[model samples]
Target: MSAPAPHGPAFSGRVGWGSRPAVLVVDLCRAYTEPDGPFALPDPGPAVEATSALVEAARASGRPVVWTAVRYAAGLADGGLFVRKVPALAAFAEDAPGDWGALTLEPGPGEPVVVKQYASAFSGTSLAATLHAAGVDTVVVAGVSTSGCVRATATDALTAGFRPQVVRQACADRSATLHDTNLADLDAKYADVVDLPEALAHL
Candidate 1:
């Protein structure tokens, strides 16, 4: 079998930072960070630290910081088909034990928390409107499961007319392969996959 052709030269357009940018911390809850949580990642320390730095930088610069977390009604009545697809989402149930859905990086004063039941933060949520109201033209993304929520949010951010800058070191997945491949694809098409320092500078 031959190797697949490279994605380069064609999808290589950069949607760099815009005049107004917001830092979006997606689903950095205990469910993914804690060892005993149902959806725990193998190593979330580095990603968490990187994300924390981004948050601090955004706050220091007076840039908006928005957070998203999955939360379902009792019995997951609001979870819809997504819960069936990923049963582990039960960890985010409103009444789940150990506060598994609690954000590991707590939002500061005046930061909005967007509760969602799906992967894409913009799906059925007011994220777009929130960003628009704040005059945010670019979204600096940092969070977990690179192949899932991070990818979904970045794609949707582009569709909603926001420049998506994904912080490479501020995201984690079940494995390194998933993290690297998804970032590569996102950088090629949907976003600019940047390092923590670049993201901080943008803030």
Candidate 2:
């Protein structure tokens, strides 16, 4: 068989799954998943279903399962740059209906829920410390807006000395193009982007 022509410059490196792993579910809230919910995506069904599976695998393995949500203060004063860049962020303000921020996953007792005003779960949040305290050396990332929160969290995970593995089917975005593009980029340079089955096997 003939080798395919090369496309872009090779961006090489892999941060394989580490000994201790944690599942980080980012913003799979009603806002992004429910059709009538604020900040709703056209279709988050697949990602929601896939993430539920990841959560189950994590639980079965007894790994830490952490969740992240975006919530701005009553007036959006704390949102700052992020809100200004994406006005739709106002949907996450506290003044909005409670269901908007409701998580798709039914978090069990003692599961930590990290709240942030930015894309990265680690930004202005104790996520890294939480992971470190739990002795987690690898972060299994899954959630909404593949081009945004998932990507940001995965990138920051790498910077924080944790191997990030993004489950492709478990991360979503309003735009398929954006989702696929960012996943490709992440797989190339930042994280290991694997399918749902592979992610479960990793767990």
Candidate number of the best TM-score: 1
Candidate 2 residue-wise lDDT, 1-203, digit = tens: 97743334566467888899889999989888888876678888888899999999999999999999888899998988889989888888989765588888789788999999999999989999999999999999999889899999999999999999999999888898999999988988899988889889878
Q: In candidate 1, what are the lDDT values of residues 1-203, reduced to their tens digit?
A: 97654774578589988999999999999989999888889999999999999999999999999999999998999999999999989878888778998999989999999999999999999999999999999999999879999999999999999999999999999999999999999998999999998888878
Clash pairs for candidate 1: none
List ranges where model 1 is wrong by over 4 Å.
1-6
lDDT of each: 0.93, 0.89
Candidate 1 lowest-lDDT run of ten: 3-12
